[model samples]
Target: MTSWVKFTVSIPDTHQDALVAQLSTAGFGGFVQEDDYIDCYVEKKKWTSGVQTRSREVLQRFAKEYPKLELRTETTDVEDRNWNAEWERSAGIVDATKKIVIKPSWKSLRRRDKGKIVLHIDPKMSFGTGHHETTRVCLRLMEYYVRRGDHVADFGTGTGVLAIAAAKLGASRVIAVDTDSWSFENASENVLRNKAGDRITVHKGSIVALGKRPFDLVVANIDLPTITKFLGRLLTLTRKGGVLILSGLLMTDLVPVLRLINRRSIIPLLLADEGEWIGFALQRT
Candidate 1:
């Protein structure tokens, strides 16, 4: 039998969702946030307990780092396994950058002059729904960077949205990549849905799995620290003087991340920001 633990935290209402998202990425499931309080359940293994401790530590760290924010933590049961099933009933539409509409399988695409692009996305258990800040920033960057008939490479392609968007923008060929099997499967399905199955090729593996072929443009919406760590490899993947659109960063994280890339001779040509998210357009020098 698997054991589990629950944490109930008193987080500010405004910051509850972000806190939940961070915890979700940390592997603690069962999120409930209401009236300045957040709750979560964690699997009760040694590693999970360590994560719980570390999560509390991070809450304390964040409190010290951002003094205005407040969060409280308590531990709770994995009573209902069927909780995730409720998600299917709540499947709905998501709007992306520039009013782009992403509809779930339950919804139908309607033609409208709302100046919004429509995408058919039945993500199932996959991540990239274009609802996250990082994905949204990347979409905006893709719109700005992709050129008609350009060859594009989308690293960490969550739902193949970036690659499909590139194809929609007239990229002759698109290579979509992700390490997770679930994402790879969903991306392949999503590409077919958008009638981009022919133009975009879905590859399952890390950025390394993408062979030595250089691309006219490479866009990675992974977080700042990851970007910094992989900057060299990313540079090697781009053609001489190709554009790199990097997002999934907070304003505070952008500078140091950019500095690391700058050392590698990558230069930022544009900086775009929305909400607390920031993205950059960099060109190889």
Candidate 2:
């Protein structure tokens, strides 16, 4: 019987991705974005005063940037049973792409979708359920690049969606890494549910968990701050001629991120933009 904390924030859609990423790092997990408001939920045991303060700081920073936007904030306590029902109602099936379909374990698939590639993801408190633009961007790019017998690594793999997809897409092996315990557990469960235990291994640590092994395809679908901090390490983890996919980027982050990328010897292959969110596919030199 785990209680939950719900934060209801009203802001423009333009800043949603940045908010979601910041909240994720701040300890908030479950997210639901509506037309005018985005609701963030976290287990009460994990949402400490520090997390609340950080969440407020995130909103204040956004307010400073867009003073005219009506960014209102509301906080409430949700009972465990209540949150479960809410999550189920909002967790509908997502037809992420022509070939990829993501659905929660509680839901059943349609007859028409029986032929498509399916991912049964129960995103308890983690991310990457293919409900976000960043997830979809990375998924499409992975479909295009993952070759047979290739090894893949999914950094900040929230619910192991991308890692599982990599295993199904012909990767010989997949490593999914997340530093947070919530994500690590959720991803581990998903990997087993997808029957990718033989091909995918979930690690609960930083990039160091990957050791010195280079991957054929590396994906870091994390926020701007994380990407900036580990860009060099991320590049080093990709072998020469291997591919790296970076997501959870807002359009505003492109210039600074590109400046970082330009410092390296990587070749950009694809840029998929969905609204203000985008994902980059680059090849190591």
Candidate 3:
């Protein structure tokens, strides 16, 4: 019998996206967003003491920053069963663009979707189902910039949706990297499922694994803080005039992130907002 540790955080609506992004980076998976709270689950085997500590720290910082919000946190342990079925029941086909449709293995597309490119993904606890606003915008930006024979790097490649899309859109080679072992495994499985194993390589680590190799385009659908931390490295890895797409940001994160990008002389190519999330596309100068 498998088990999971579920953590629920009660946060102000204004801070939901930022907190969710932080938790996701801390290796929490299978999130359920509510009106005023977010629930995240991690398999007991993967929920280490360090992860708990980091999650607490993030929540504590938020609490201190916004005392009026009265943030609350709780955790529980429960037996895991039939989560895949639950996920499938809740997730339907996502139309990322006119040309891109994301569907779980269990769902079938309608007759009208015959001409669209479909990405079959089974996240299985990893993120990026193409259902999130951030991922959808990232896919749209990827469609606009990715070209045939382009080499792409998908940083924080949860579930490899973006990397898979790059390959499907004609990238010659795609490197998908994530620090979480589960995400690496899940993304690998999805790559094979999408018949992209021959063109995509999944790595369980950060950008350093690439070792000075530059990519024609780089896509990072991660949080603002994490993206800021890796901004310089991401810029370095992108070829001059190459495209860089970033998502998983909130409206509040826009100013600070843009300041960091401007300091690096990166040119902003596009800015998109969906719901409360934001995505940016830039070109290496």
Candidate 4:
């Protein structure tokens, strides 16, 4: 039987998101943060020696970035089981948009959800549920930008929620891309769960691999660094006058990201702010 490794990461400082981003990049998912520690889960097979080395390297680098940051990780072996079902029991339905709802696979909708579009998401080993501010903001942005017959690209499509939402919202073709193996697999399954497999194709790499296809809309709900890294190319991938949505940024990221967008001659048409996270919508025309 396959097992799971739970890393109870303890941090001495409040710069937890930095570690969360690093862990996500390191292919760890299903993060549960608490007052003093964060729990990160990974499949036993993928918890290779190389992954451990890379994780240490990230911590060493993070020490330099945040002088007060001190990280301690303790690993626990977990038996393979239906973790998603456990999560579903506690996962409440969220009205991601007025017309769009996000619910777990086993949950039944109430009368209030009538006429709403429900996305049956199962994040077995990925980091996207509609509960986070970033995810909700990105979904809201899609509500405004995703048009009927639009070709959309969702970069870092964890659990494929945004791509599925785009497909449900009327995008003719939706391409969901993720670099993490778990995310790719989880998103692919969610795509099938939502019955959006016909319209959404899950790609297992960066957006660059998809070539120069003109997408009517491109959404990237990843961290600030990742967003900045691909902002230029993402802009180019969208057709002229098409929409681009960027999220997963802390409030501190506003200035630099806005400056980067300004340099590219792209003007943000809308700003979606939820808590400390903010998302922007830009039209390439």
Query: Which one wins on lDDT?
Result: 2
- Runs in model 3 deviating more than 4 A are 10-18, 33-37, 45-49, 60-70
In terms of lDDT, the poorest run of 10 residues in model 4 is: 12-21
Residue-level lDDT of model 3, residues 1-285, one tens digit each, is 889988988876667766776677677867877789888888899899988988888888667656778777888997977878868766889988879999888887888789888999997878889777888989989989999999999999989999999999999999989988878999999999999999999999988975688999999998877887898899899999899999888777888987888788688999988887899999998
Clashing pairs in 4: none
Q: Which pairs clash in model 2?
A: none
Which of the two candidates, 3 or 4, achieves a greater TM-score against the reference? Answer: 3
After superposition, the stretches of candidate 1 with alpha carbons farther than 4 Å from their true spots are: 1-10, 20-61, 74-85, 89-91, 110-116
Candidate 4 Cα misplacement greater than 4 A, ranges: 11-22, 34-36, 48-72
Ranking by lDDT: 2, 3, 4, 1
How close is every model to the real structure, measured as TM-score?
Answer: 0.80, 0.92, 0.90, 0.86
120 in model 2: Cα distance from truth in Å? 1.3
* Tens-digit lDDT string for candidate 1 (87-113): 455456766776567776667666662
Model 4 Cα lDDT, one tens digit per residue, 170-216: 99898888888788999998998988888999989988755699799
* lDDT, candidate 2, 98-138, per-residue tens: 89999898898998897899998987768887778889999
User: Which sections of candidate 2 miss by over 4 Å?
Assistant: 1-3, 12-18
- Which clashing pairs does model 3 show? none
